[model samples]
Target: MPNVVLLLAALAFAGCDVFESSEPVAFTRIALPARPVLVNGTTVVRGDYQLSAFTRSVNDSLISVPTIDFDRQTVLGVFYGGSFHAGCRGNVETIEGIRLAGDALIVEVGPLPDLGPCRAIVYPSDMVVVNARATSVRFVGAVPQ
Candidate 1:
């Protein structure tokens, strides 16, 4: 009986470490819009913001979602979940001082304050056929419709 009690106590203590060391899953992908999108009434070139990828990190509770952007070789933007203080619930708000290469389109999230560059690739599953003009570009499986 005493051994069983000790084992239970040890198991309970170990569970706390499970949440402590686990990092949130970060999703990275390149998203292309169906059609050309206009930013501030300006028609953004097709390839200008096309090859961009983003990484978003979510907490264990799935409340706040912070995103970071990597455009070919530059960090475009960083947005935090300020409005959704309880959990991950708000859209990415761009961080100032960081300029996206060419035009602003896709963004991502990171743990540090530095953006890393990476090559962009369009996946087969990400291709979508649409007739209307696209307004924004996002990472695959990152943005919610």
Candidate 2:
């Protein structure tokens, strides 16, 4: 009877909302053909022209980042700026969470996987379409080095 009561208590506490922010922002990850070389750190792009210019900075082959409706959505780009092994690919795991706090969007980046035996150098980058209008973004729990 005691074991059952303890189990029930644990489950009940687990179900309770632990995160401070309850309001979540909708987001979708987008793929890029090559890693961006110019833009580094967190970037908030609200206009088509800004996004277009960012894509042009990539030195790799001509690529097309997913066309987003700037009026309805915004793009958030997170780049590590550091080079990693070729096996370390970004976006392999889903983004953890995005929540709204006041007018700022708080983004949580999940861990990066370790693929064995990497010889070539590569840059880790990720882009997501957030379905909310925010003036700024705060990144938490960034990609593991």
Write the residue-wise lDDT of candidate 2 on 1-145 in tens digits.
9999999999988876554554898888877665545434666789987777777666544544566778778887777545544654544443578888877788888765563356555556677888888787788886434
Question: 124, model 2: CA deviation in Å?
Answer: 1.3
Off by over 4 Å in 1: 21-145
- The reply for model 2, stretches above 4 Å from the true place, is 1-20, 35-40, 60-64, 86-91, 143-145
Residue pairs in collision within model 1: 35-134, 63-87, 63-88, 64-87, 64-88, 67-108, 67-109, 68-108, 68-109, 69-108
- The CA lDDT at 39 in model 2 is 37
TM-score of each: 0.21, 0.69
How does residue 113 of candidate 1 score in lDDT?
Answer: 27
